[model samples]
Target: MTNGGWFNHYDDPDEFWDDEPLPIERTPLNPSPSPSPPQNPSSPPQKVVPTPKPVEPQPWTTGPVSKSAGAERLQSGVGSSFVAVQVDAGLLPVHVQLSPQWHRHVDGSEAGAELMRAYQKAIGIYLGETIKSGKYFSGEFRHPSAPPDRRTVLMLLLETASWADYRETQTRIYARNGFEVHGQAQIQNEPVTSMRANWFQVKSIRIWPDWARRADPIQIVDEVLCCANRVRELRPTFKIRGDYSRYSDEDLEYQHLQHRENLIEELGV
Candidate 1:
């Protein structure tokens, strides 16, 4: 109160709480059993209507949904579907439509379409075209916001990525992080040194399909950054490029000689 420009409630701070009495915690007897009001006895005996049993749902075999139902729902476009997974449960087989966060992040990216395609393809391969009555793949993985810095995910991507594109992207990512990657170009034709086997193609829709579908944005960036740093640490040949790294000795010398020649030609009688 003194500093806030408000008058103090009491002149003596000790007087208010010092003499305060504690409240008594007494329990009252005769607790009401039920809160319903007393009913009138004079009313004529009312007829008790029996509740009708609910109609049992038809079996999946007998009750197939019309194809138009799905089309109508999709056309509504009131909400987005982020997660699409094959499910086998209950009598009717169906996919649980969830909005996965990956769909949100990758929707606009050039890779987004590819990711969706991979996810679709995986569903069929993993669970089959028609969802059976059973649990298939559960999107329960607690994907980190960014991939791990351990480069595990990056290595997977690199293994599948086209050698040139993967190498180039890896180099640029490393450079952006203030480092360089060695043997980036050498990776093109050289025996695979990073992984034990090579199965993925550059821009293959199959690279970490489920992972791409579930990982959050933060986890995705984390994986790339962690991998880049790990790669730089592993390869010592990769050096830090200086400002003049782009200019070769030959280029510099030729430029200087041309300048000198021009000066001499201009000055000659």
Candidate 2:
């Protein structure tokens, strides 16, 4: 064999290829999506509210007042033989009981006068008892020697003057308005009585004794009370029409002192 072509270098072939390294492959990535612009949240709807108002006052109105204790019926008679009279708180006669003996004793013409006398007696007795009970006059007033203080005296005078002025004003108003109310009662087809009243007091009471005598006492009293109540119901409301404004306490006291001095001088006391 030819030595140059046939015989190659075989002793170090594996050792010569052991020093080289291998290459690696990779894929491309997609770009991320742009973030959305920030937005403001809508504000919640708001609630609403409201306001309030005021009140007013009223005026005084007069009407029937409740009767006092033991004021329902007050009766008086003379010796059980004469006539008897029953009256209410205002001393308005409600009933008259005439005995047979009284009717026989009094002449037919004198019956009305005798009944009136009995009514007067009843009023007197009622006033006496009222005074004794300290109801009519509550010891507020005293004799000149034991008079109340100057302030109290002035107050009393002012109150009296105020009441008088009010009464006078009310009277005029009643007259102008024709504020009289009338009520009547009948018994057994006969007219028994007719009552007339104004805002302040009973104006007139006309009774037919002949018809009233025939009716029961209780019935008569009931009729009278009914009439009185009717008058109250029918009484019209009126605005208080008086200059109730009063002088100052100092002025009232000065006037009282002056009056007292004048009285003392005039009486030479």
Candidate 3:
């Protein structure tokens, strides 16, 4: 039953009574501060890149060989050297010709004359058959510098061959010196045992370095065969090299008779 122009209030305590709107309070507009970088609780520690250290080469050791020293001498070849395998001992013998003093004398006091005699015979028979058979040279057959007495050294040189052949030849020569056979039937064997043994060794020597040496027994044989052919071509009939023809058949018969009479008297027959 109350009447008002623009305001009315009853039992409500928080009620607005105005004919116009109330003014809003002004708020200070400050630009929000730039957000700080986000902190990561689980971030890993930074890795450090290591710089490489320069390396120096180790120096050569002059110290003696020992477990404690932990050092070794650097070895090297000085010059040309010969390596010999001992057939009997099965050892490696290094024949280094570093000086003339190391060279052995063939005719020194230590040299055995009997051994030398056997050696010459072996060489002559072996070489002769090789020449006759036509084989290639093994590098071993070289004349080590000859001494003043040519007879003592008996240095014979053939063309160069493999080192192996040289070794085999030396072994054969020594072996022939002490050669012996049980049976006497071999005594009458043609060319003789000594000759056969020597010739066999010569052939064996040719086997080593056949490619490099180009050695063949057939070559030697061919030479001899060709030589014989040439000799036949020159003079078909066999004739003595010397003037043995000067002695007539009658003269030879007389000499034979005289030798027979002397042999009969010496034998008391």
Candidate 4:
């Protein structure tokens, strides 16, 4: 029974011709290219960080300065009345008042009395006692009792020069003495350089007069007479214009008109 044809097939070691049928052959799995090991992620292309830009600086400006760099020490409010004038006219005596900034002496002494006496003398000279000329001079010392600590404001006239020049000199004097330039007036035909002159007269001398009396007609006449005499002394031969009418009582009234006319002549305005 063991060799009888495929002994009931089940018992046959090799049934039919060789195996049931030839087994199919499989192709080699082409090693999927090893997936390139993910290329090590290429270090994420070295996250190139961008460079920062530079900032520029700006310029700094300063505000207004409170005080002048080299201002002089003055007797406080007294600076307001420190009037100076340059005149073609000769030296003329006049009165002046002391600045309020002058402190009174603590002790009543002879020296103080002497100072007061000198101040009185100055006043007398200003009031035409020393001035024989028709020109009038008048001023009063503010602190006659305390002359030791007081500053004086003198009123003097100049003789023989043009008024224009005189006015300029006066302005320069006060300017050098810490007085600010307030205003300037120009006069035609009277080109005096002195602040006392019409051309360069200060519009308003902002001083609180210690002597509260308004300059009266008598005082004016005396001043004019003294001024005229001063003019004679300055130039014995040259005629001096002693006419007060020539100078306007109010310099502001026609200052602009005068300045404009002068400028028009100078710049063909």
Best by TM-score: 2
Model 3 misplacement above 4 A? 1-245
- Flag the better candidate by lDDT, 2 or 3: 2
Query: What lDDT tens digits, residue by residue, belong to model 1 across residues 129-230?
Result: 222322222333211222233233233223322445444644533432222222121223641111110111112211244544454544433333333334
Q: Please provide, for model 2 over 4-89, each residue's C-alpha lDDT reduced to its tens digit, 9 standing for 90 to 100.
A: 32222465533333433344454447756779766556866456755555532211111112122222233233423467876555
Error of 1 at 238 (Å): 7.4
Off by over 4 Å in 4: 1-170, 176-242, 246-248
Clashes, model 3 = 11
Evaluate candidate 3 by giving its C-alpha RMSD to the native, one decimal: 35.9
TM-score, each model?
0.17, 0.33, 0.15, 0.16
Candidate 2 achieves a global lDDT of: 0.49
lDDT string, candidate 4, 37-89, tens digits: 44466566557788988753211111112111111111111222222222221
* Candidate 4 Cα RMSD after full superposition onto the native fold (Å): 34.9
Off by over 4 Å in 2: 1-82, 94-114, 139-183, 186-191, 195-205, 209-219, 223-269
User: Lowest-lDDT window of 10 residues in candidate 3?
Assistant: 83-92
Candidate 4: 10-residue stretch with minimal lDDT: 66-75
Tens digits of per-residue lDDT for model 3, 205-267: 111122212323233223223322232232211112334345565555565456445544665
Best model per lDDT: 2
